[model samples]
Target: MPLEEIQHWTWVFGRAQQMMLDYSLREIEKARTNDPETPMSGFAAAGGAMLKAQTDFWSDSLKLWQRFLMPEEAPSEARALSEEIGRRADRDKRFSAPAWRDSPLFDLVRQSYLLVSDHLLKGVDAIDGLDARQKERIRFATRGFVDAMSPSNFPLSNPVVIEKTLETRGENLLKGLDHLLSDLGRGQLTHTDSGAFEVGRNVAVTPGKVIKRTPLYELIHYQPTTPQLMRTPLVIFPPWINRYYILDLNPEKSFIRWAVSQGLSVFIVSWKSADAGMKDVTWDDYILRGQIDAIDTVRDLLGVDAVHAIGYCVAGTTLAATLALLAARGEADKVRSATFFTAQVDFADAGELTLFVDDDQLSVIDALANDGFLDGRYMAATFNLLRSRDLIWNYVQNNYLLGQDYAPFDLLYWNGDTTNLPALWHRSYLTDLYRDNKLVQPGALSVDGTPIDLSLVKTPAYIQAGREDHIAPLQSVWKLTEHFAGPMRFLLAGSGHIAGVVNPPTSGKYQYWSHEGTAATLSEFLEKAVETKGSWWPDWIRWIEALDDTRVAARAARMPGKGRLKALEDAPGSYVRAR
Candidate 1:
């Protein structure tokens, strides 16, 4: 249902309840007047009953509140607050609720906010009789409500905004207004200053050439930087929801360039940003016309029977499906090995993203996509809501309230560079994978006249999941091992979706966990895991080397037109730069 309609009905229900209470009070008075011969004790008893009901309601609320303040078992929020206090004493103010230290009143406000949030979360857990979908909706709605009510959202309540305003003599407020007006004109929220970065010049600046082009995507073969090359080539399939430049953000962080330097020929599939003309493109088109086509191009260019493949996010899921189709066709040998990064083929426990997906929500989305495609802004908004405090409200407070401009952050820059989804493909994905969860069932999904059964894929697999990923939970991604009939290796990385994947060995930032053997459950895997410092890239490199036994002599890098595929354009191709 529409939020406005829900609000309207809630108002009507409240008024009806108030009217019933007033009618009951009026009846009590009339009964007392009509029964004067009888005692006034009956009227007193009735009044006491009403008072007792009100008391019971508050008594339950108090008990719920007490759970938040339990000394023996402090909630996660309480522990977080204590840690924040220590950090604040050391002059760290990176956290959102800086006003908590301004005054006891502000501190009380923070406590009340946390207490209510904790209670609402617990209340959802305590709820019974509701189906999984209903409970998910309740939890999601409650989180949204709590996020909106945070103290930092209001100017008067947030000390950082107040401090900035006073420091700038209210000039900050004027700039903030300008920022708001600019974003409104654009019809989207600005996560980063768009003017600070450009696509081909500084962002996706790696030296490469577009070797092939199709209606759905572009195939870019990066120039090799190593002295010798592995016999097997590598092809990457990035998620179509965002630009492929995320993997090749810049020189310092470009995974594509790193792969090339590691003596491996790299090829990436850059999906076109869908529009009205491409609305008819289906999931089969993405698999056959996009991924499978790119695989064929790479195999012909390298003159190899098979090539190593890597997939990230949604692309990873599609790659798995495509492999299944290949297996059914007795052509599974086309891919030497498969690696999946933060992707879920089994959507049984897809985490919070599933909360906004159901028959009703899909219908609403279908109506919006009647124009041929779901606008990129809508997709971006949905993702921002998943991390509203970090992605939405933080930007709101910074750009609107504090009047601060966003600095040039590569990840946020890539985030703002959104892409639209074709109507048919988007609808099919939500209906089949998310709602119906058809990918796990044999013959449930078909592509290019072939039935897909993931177990038929006998190629060795390497799967990595982010421990803190909100979109594809570790538990969900780990389930991929159960479906594959080949040898499998699973790695659990630290941080959320983007950070976890982009982590480099030089950064020494996040740690990853590895186990010798697969366990029965995700928890069991974690129980027997060993922590390793630095990035998982080196580990992956070693694994890839083990898969390929042939090490060839040093050779000069292949040019774009040198291959039979022929060059279409320069690197970072046209599709990625299309709006």
Candidate 2:
């Protein structure tokens, strides 16, 4: 702590304490004046009651602190002692009064004290909050703090306490502080091994021969072991929200490999991570320019009139938009059929995420977009908060108190991968699609003066929903089936978002259920279908294979010439990098 920072913090702490004292005294006076004869059961408790509680909490906190910072003492002994002191304190009634039951002065003063306490505590540089097992481990590790006079972890770890200290400064102050902590945590977790990187690395392990496309991005083409190939090739459109390699992860889990093995030519789109140059790239540009370019490149190389397309998550939205845009321009003949993996086109019921995307929030986002791109850390933090009890709290307990090294879990590592959204596009997306619910309704959204109509899309569609997807709730994604006029099949998977999509047959525990005869919401489908244990991927492949044409296509006389690489050595491409 620098002298300047210490001084600033002290000043804030003093001011907050003063506010708390003033509020407490004022409330006390009000109580006396309002009902002079009333028994002071609540607000008339002894002054030392608050003091005693504070003292007790501090005593326990100090003991815990010593266990961590002290030398020459065994951690187990220290922890046991801390627990004993906590038990003793817990037995005392004086310190156990609920906030509502406490005297007005005590309640107000304590809360004010909390404002100062929080800042002082966070200044210690420790993560706050812990899961059950983690809290148990901390208690065990800091037993020595059981009877210490000085507190360890005495102060609240929440950042809100500091914000209360700076409330007069402005709400923006709190927002900025929150953004700082969020960015710090995100940067640490997403240092490098993000989901995007993992996907790229794992794709290289597919069973068939792999040929490098753009070395910079590790974009490659795969040839199946089987000689027979389907008439029309398959091109996968992955959500830019994550890397494209999720479809081609490990050998057993590889959807792309499975497709190729089923005798189909498969092409996967590997997106490039945008930089300052891509700041102005609009949603329309992605579909019209990016997707169209990839399709043209594929067609020119393969000489295929139409390609089977699969889109997942946000990419499904892009694919939907591309189909709509293409249809409006009479280019629908290029698409044979489409499959959506938990993609949402209608945001009418976008799950718990909707609560945070009102008009007021969009305005703030609009201002943030002035820099052209919205920081990926901001989005990552928001998602982490959604599961705060699990992600944030668990990390704090494991890493800080126990001094344990973070164990690597591929799912969690991938979860930590954060990506940025262009501010303009993010703002427009939230306001137009989520807040307004426009795409499904006619004349709601106009791209380049042309309206987007979902009913106009007549491509055969297969839409699958996971039972538990926090990002795109099953109900919202299922709404797409209602809007599409083409023949559509709806399937339900047993797991959550990423797990459900990356379903490998070997997992063996997965179950798929469907309504069969009726076309309704996912909930309705699950209600009528039988539960069977098996991977949805194999089932999906089977359905897709049945729909595919059987004629085998020999190797073409000409193949798509390799494109020039931006970097001869891999720098950073879309799949191998984080947002």
Best candidate, TM-score-wise? 1
Error of 2 at 70 (Å): 38
lDDT of 2 at 479: 90
Cα deviation at 412, candidate 1, in Å, is 0.2
Please state every model's RMSD to the true fold in angstroms: 8.7, 13.8
**Cα lDDT tens digits for candidate 1, 260-349:** 889888889999999899978999998998888889888877778998999999999999998898999999999999999999999999
Off by over 4 Å in 2: 1-204, 207-220, 363-370, 521-523, 557-575
Candidate 2: tens digits of C-alpha lDDT, residues 1-579: 354553454355445544655555555555555566544434444332443343334443443444333423637755665445444433433223342123332332333333234333332223234454444434432332221211211113223223333554544434434544654765643322243445446443553222233311233445545666777777777776565666765677777777777777776666655445557767776676566656665565666788788888887887887778778879887888888998999997787566568667677777765667776656766676555535554444234322333454555655555555666666777777777888888767766667878889998888888888888888888898888888888888887787888877777767877655875666677678777687777766666677766666445411212323122223123344545
- TM-score of every prediction relative to native: 0.85, 0.64
